[model samples]
Target chain A: MSASATPVALGAARPGLFGFTRAQAVGFLLMLAAIVVLPHVLYPIFLMRILTAALFACAFNLMIGYVGLLSFGHAAFYGMGAYVCAWTLKFWHLDAAAAILLGGLTGGLLGLALGYLAIRRSGIYFAMITLALAQMVYFFCLEAPFTGGEDGIQQVPRGTAFGIFPLHQDMAMYWLVAGIFIAGFLLIHRVIHSPFGQVLKAIRENEPRATSLGYRTMHYKLIAFVISTFLSGIAGATTSVVFGIATLDGVTSARSGDVVLTTLVGGLGTVFGPVVGAIVTTSMENYLAQFGSWVTVTQGAVFVVCVLAFRRGIVGEIAAKLRLSL
Target chain B: MSEILLETHGLTKEFNGFTAVDNVDLQVRAGTIHALIGPNGAGKTTCFNMLTKFLPPTRGRIHFKGRDITGIAPADVARLGLVRSFQISAVFPRLTALENVRLALQRARGNSFDFWRSETALRRYDNRAHQLLFDVGLTGLADTAAGLLAYGQKRALEIATTLALDPEMMLLDEPTAGMTHADVDRIVELIRSIRTGRTILMVEHNLSVVEGLCDTITVLTRGRVLAEGDYATVSRNPEVIAAYLGSDAPELAHA
Candidate 1:
């Protein structure tokens, strides 16, 4: 249509490599290098824990940010992975790779079932349904014979790497955690740039329009939910191996809160936002561990400050200001 | 060419006890510009919603290309080459203009649920998408997000996306609702240019627009069809005139 005035042109550049603009690639590379050398400088176990949490947050972002579905109970998948991985390592004595993958598969199947029910309702209804179902999974985990209730599945063998490395050394286990995190990150990146991901964004932006365009929006949402939950499950599995325990805390509402807080503080939609968020939040908890309950107070303050100061999250604000597609 | 392409029999919709549409039978012949126009609360939108399968009729049936489509989903109806544009501009605001059109083209090609492949394969659609955007006069704004586009430009984007569907028939609801004079004139040209091989059904309020563009007009009042015929014949009907401007005796004009 010929309007009196023409529209302005902004953000016309094509993104590079998996929806990351050139600037985003640079940011990602810098972060990658920092993490690669992180163990030498900081404690390997502490760094490994943060990496695991970061992967979980990134998985959560894929649902809430790209798909526009706020899942407040991501612990269902994360804890499912932890419980399965721990049980397999303790009882079945499976290899680390197989055990972690089994955990991710469990998450996928659970996501498929839960997504079928949760996606039936949207907005607050969708969130409440997921929270309620996740609580059911939590109860199952608490009462299950293998999980050991209060003690959890303790001393989960990290297991050997394809009959090779025993994964007994802390650095060796750190690499395993790092590898899983990197794999999850790359998979999410690939998915976000795929044609399927485009449909997901379309559904997010205006679902009614997308439906009118002949897309079965529900199917797209389900697939995205499965992918996100599967990745999150992997992160949880990796965490149990790193800590040698998969406690009830892993599947609790508190864990879900941690992932949500991490995603928001880092950035909701930015590709690198979750990592930044995970690092900042994990560092705060680690450094303030001596303060006991004050850690929760500090995290709440951080969330408030983040919401007040940078609603787009740190990386999101930067990406918008720079016109980069991060 | 004179055969009916879409027909509805006694289509009615009731929200609670209030009747939004009541026992309306309608038909659209192939390759004609049919306009649906009524005053506010005349059930034009409700009727259009039923035609597009956006809302189910309480007690009626819809036939599209001779297929029973009353129970079909809106997306399935579009898949059958029947497409409807929204009264509100429904472009994905965060996506770039090219990406929006590209997404429509992809859907038209039945590419939904295909996420395993890299999006680089979508580059094959670039030339056609760029052409569609260019036809809509969005030459350099391809990379701009739809939300950043001006109001008129967003409407143009909506048209381009609908056009990407390449429908045999288009159901456009208020294609020029909030446009300026210049924009309205431009959209009229677009509508005229697009109708060489496709049929169009539209809902319009601007009588001049109806008179200038529509080959046939259906006038409604209070959930019932008042008159249906060529624009000149319908406009001259005294009942149509009174129902619009307010009837003197109020005898519940034609239905």
Candidate 2:
């Protein structure tokens, strides 16, 4: 058992550009090219909706995918972000950037309050805790005076982003939404690859092992939860800005389920999976809306198929095929 | 005499009125290999968990480096230079072996909250991580995902990751519980190589390995210390023979 007697094969790891394998880098470029060109081929408003959903799903993935925490009430942050952003934009007359930032802050603050309690219990209990907390927020929105009871905040102004670029034009608003989506996507990517992200992965892999290595697992989980909710907040804020309305529909428990389905279909833990899943699921709802109640049935079928056929989701499967970490 | 590095006073644990570990006192000397050996349900693991602060003792005081640590958090205990490994191989299965070692070494960077900084910042630890791997005979498997490593190799990797902390003392739970003769010998050699300047307290099932490596042995049975001494002295104790060795007493004495 001498050290010299051990086998000496070099590892199979390959260097990549910007931490992405060749395949991932190519996929990223293709996705970016589509982002830029899609406005010309498709409706910009519809695309903006997809971008918001994409960002929301990516933020949700930070919990379930990276940290192995299934947050059942993520829509609480998303819906609250929308309500806050809409309130600021309509009443306070804040600029787009400020409104979105405030929305994210609201989500982060709310996440801190709920996550402190939720992370104390793990697995299904954690999920139940989050769901219960989010439901409370949903009821608060329903009864709150500022939330307009059933109507929500309507006719939200899409003012200039940073008070310079006019966001009244559909293209201008689309660009703003696109910019937010990309920046949020990269930020999530950066967090997942950072030293902090490394600890999160270790905690996700074996929590007791990480604790034995001197990591405060609770603190790490709390921080990750806040960051995730903050991102979800902005995604919600962006959606309201794009649509000019913040409705009860956005805060419904169904929205929480929708985000989960989006991420699950995209690939639960894959970096790009949530975005792909968001696009697929959001597009399905849009196209299937004519069928009314049948939309839920179709989504249920898709969820069943995805779970049974490819548990890894679309991006997870592709990454597995190519042996990449995307 | 070596200075006492870790000591326990009347350590006890009761789960729903069933006494798991009862009124056990343990003293481990600095810079020595101490083995806690006992038969099945002898409370070796329960006692180890108390020392590591994984389980709170119903009645006990633990002193490490002359400081009481019974009430401290488990992470803080590890930060105080006392680390422990699991009975089961506890590697981060998805992480590459280098990444796993680098994770332990990353603690030296302080307050692992650099979420905004790129992970390439951790590349600086590659040399030290590689060296630790080399010491544990895992250099060849550095790039392998820990889940892919063989059982013996994973145990070796666990030791390497544990060593990355450079702790003053280590508590290993069943380091070679399931290993071939060659793997056991290799681990004994590896343990010996890394024994310098650090104290090791291990719960080992293989008596022969303990005989070869441990400076002192503590034998426990049914949650109580039946005998404590050098291998030759304790193996000859009739109480130990009756309680632990039983039918294998002759072979145990020869070994």
Candidate 3:
């Protein structure tokens, strides 16, 4: 094969440990440093908001970016995680870690069932199936007696961390939220670089070919979906703990759209794009909250700009221009 | 050799009210190169698809390696050692050439679900992937993405990736379709090199390629077999000539 035969960047992958390109390693360190200092420089709750949303977007990206799936109902997992965590923490009185784990497990189970059905279809139909299933989940939450309907599960207790550290303090809760976000972020990286991730990419790029090559493409897709949903659940559960509420907004379509915006704003397939996108989007929402309905218009404007000026999204454009993979 | 590697009986496919493939019986022997040739709309592709389990035959029984595999998924067919290539050169476009081959190798190893292990664990197949690439003249393009490769290189990469599976029987669906003569010759040689120990069932158009590479030929017309023999015998068959090559008899004869 000739050098000219290969396309640049996306296709011209250089060898790395666990799939980290040189730019990815550098980007990871920068993100680490920023997170360590972020709480001190910014409002802790607001920063936590960004962290939670960031993790959600990153998990969404694993399905969107690596697996070439566009899930319109990801908020289903996120919201479900939040409700499960809140219920477990408040009623069952489980430790924080156990609650989060249980929340993830709940999301995974939901994913397994939904993914089985969704993986039966592809393209727009697949997206619709997920969205419909998520809407059904939303209605379930509404009618369920435990969710408290309109009021939601308010004042969700942060409870004890390993029965020692108190999470009642907002500052104390921030660390756990940040830690979960960071761990999820790194885990996504590990996954995208794994053999399973490779298969996901193969299925994403060309499904029929992957199948002809002896791959159980549907099974691989279901597993990827479950993993993505599990992580999204963890992010949602963490956010519910920090914010002390599990409401309809958690599973709403609008929330689902927000993660899509954040992922797109950062860069769909770029490694660090979703985190950066989350920060940018969260900051923009906070800055524009007083503007009321104008916030949606402003978001529309951003989407317009992103599509027209930067089809690859911010991080994607940067990675393409720099000949790097972040 | 008398051993049958793949045999399909009463294979039929109907699209709504139109019959695409009529009841057809096809047999492929082990360690031989077999070709399915016919005119357009003769259901050659539909037959190949049914044989490879990409399409369910309206009525058929397909046996591979002496096991009834009718209605099996393509993945299962592949596991049974009968892998089919697409009409177009199918590959994971965004992945590097090496990654494309490595995926096939990993799939063959029954470890595609190992999500926790780093891809470095796949490095064990790197040497073999490189060798396969080298075999198809794509060694230097290993790191290049499959989509970015030139058209001819893409076909070569596809073959290299398919070879990574170490299949007992291979299916080539128009392996050289839309290729320059130079590229076509390269594939013909590549196919020949891999045919020594394994069985091959191919659907091909270019008569010269089918003539040069295939050990036996099955000619189809109107979704049914018209002639079955060596290339020379099939080419001379009055029915094969009238139904398919009559208009291009001189051209085919020259080929």
The TM-scores, one per candidate, come to 0.95, 0.96, 0.96
Residue B22 lDDT, candidate 3, scale 0-100 = 87
DockQ values per model: 0.58, 0.58, 0.78
Residue pairs of candidate 1 with colliding backbone atoms: none
The digit string of per-residue lDDT tens for model 2 on B1-255 reads 999999999999999999989899899999999999888889999999999899999998999999999999999999999999999999988788999999999975663798888888888899999999999988777889887899999999999999999999999999998899999999899889989999999998778889869999999988888899888898888898887656456657778
Please give the TM-score that candidate 1 achieves against the real structure: 0.95
Question: Per-residue lDDT of A1-326 in model 2, one digit per residue for the tens?
Answer: 01111121113345365556566677889989999999999999889989999999999999998898999999999999999999999999999999999999999999999999999888899999999999999999999999888999999888878979879999999988998999998889888878899899899889999989888899999999999999999999999998888888777888999999999999887778999998999899899999999989999999999988988889877766666666
RMSD in order of candidates: 4.0, 3.9, 2.5
Error of 3 at A280 (Å): 1.9
Predicted model with the maximum DockQ: 3
Residue A107 of candidate 3: its Cα lDDT? 85
Candidate 1: misplaced stretches above 4 Å?
A1-10, A321-323, B246-255
Fnat values, one per model, are 0.68, 0.71, 0.86
lDDT by residue (tens digit), candidate 3, B1-255 = 669888989889999978888888988898999999988888999999888788888997989988999967888888877888888889888788999999999988856788887888888999999999999999788888788798889988888888888889999999999999999999999998888788999998889888868989998888888889898898888888788655557757676
lDDT score at residue B33, model 1, on the 0-100 scale:
95
